[model samples]
Target: MARLTNSMFPSIPSFTDRFFGGNLMDWNNWNFAGIDSTLPAVNVKESDSDFKIEVAAPGLKKSDFKLNYDKGRLTISSEKSDEKSEKNGKEVTRREFSYQSFQRSFTIPDDIVNADKISAKYKDGILHVTLPKREEAKVKTVKEIKVS
Candidate 1:
């Protein structure tokens, strides 16, 4: 029950029950902040010979991504520019797409003898990295000889 003010000749009671009061603003805020983020996926694979890494980033060109290597740290980053133009008195009504960037880095182990020989390629919405292993890392065979 809600108490009414005596200043007015007649007091008006709130139509809502105290136990069932609704705050739509709070609900809206909870939903907005609790929403999950949608980000691209990445895949990595390695063998005794080489390592392969692929990242899924659609609608991005090769020029949008930059790679840098310093002190055994490999960094990959992507950035995009917004598109805004009005030509010949044309009116645009709606815009729904959003553009954001991300960067990732990894520490290359000392066992990787030749980091300069690494290569990368971007095609079909996927970025691929190839890191070849050093010759010393390969397996070898030994023959046994018997002495009489």
Candidate 2:
């Protein structure tokens, strides 16, 4: 008689691993491996006037990032890659350069409008997204006019 063994995990890749890396363990898909360094972190804050978002992407230029807004959704994405070496130097030891990409998206609140007017800035490894509230969304200070 022969005994058979089964693996606890299926041979097929998990849905999360296929889309998000296996090492990434969170609701948000963020993986920091096989590249220069870890991916940038993102922070979002909201106020009565507007919503602010910031991402920390080190060693990345402003040109590397792409921002898109459509149907009340905003997406930020970037891809990084290293070229293969042609010349042999000192019996090449270890290589770390590899293809890595990061993507994140956020939904625009219904209270906000005019996404086209949104502004963004990238400086010192930090990306800032400013979503200004529309006139109607802003707080109002009404004054009654005196009538004679």
Candidate 3:
């Protein structure tokens, strides 16, 4: 699958690829071997006071998440590893190991956001991030000036 550089804009198929009958949405293909190789879905919402980000990641603990904010960018990523072994007569008969990781990033407009006051929480398989807007950036009513 092709990695998307920007979450806001989806990749567009080239004219040649489209004319040649190439799959424009190849990323949606989910085969048995690629079942576990998928990025979690994310939702971003903006309100008058803040912006909220929600990521759907089930079967994961809070410790699995790593969040970073720098240079007007907020990134969320996680990695997990698991190993299992079966023993027979004091000898290892079977062993299995798996590792999974994913990362998502968003560009936050610094003029409207207070990066230091950002907060996050995980609940019911959803990661929520709250980005408080700067006091100066909050919406204000326009005042009409009287003619002199």
The C-alpha lDDT values of all candidates are 0.67, 0.74, 0.81
Better of 1 and 3 by lDDT: 3
Candidate 2 lDDT by residue in tens digits, 58-137: 77888888999887788999997985654467675555577767888999864575676789999888999998888788
lDDT order, best first, reads 3, 2, 1
List model 3 lDDT by residue over 118-145, tens digit each. Answer: 9999999999999999999888879999
With a 3 Å backbone cut-off (N, CA, C), the pairs that clash in candidate 2 are none
| Residue 72, candidate 1: alpha-carbon lDDT | 66
Q: How badly does each model clash, as a count of residue pairs? A: 0, 0, 0
Give TM per candidate. 0.60, 0.62, 0.72
Query: Which candidate achieves the best lDDT against the true structure?
Result: 3
- Please write out the lDDT profile of model 1 over residues 1-148, one tens digit for every residue: 3443335533543332221243444653332212222245666787877777787877899998898877667777898867665455576655455567878776767476357778999999999988777888755567788998
Model 1 TM: 0.60
- Regions of candidate 3 where Cα sits further than 4 Å from its true position: 1-36, 142-148
Query: What clash pairs does model 1 have?
Result: none
Error of 1 at 76 (Å): 0.9
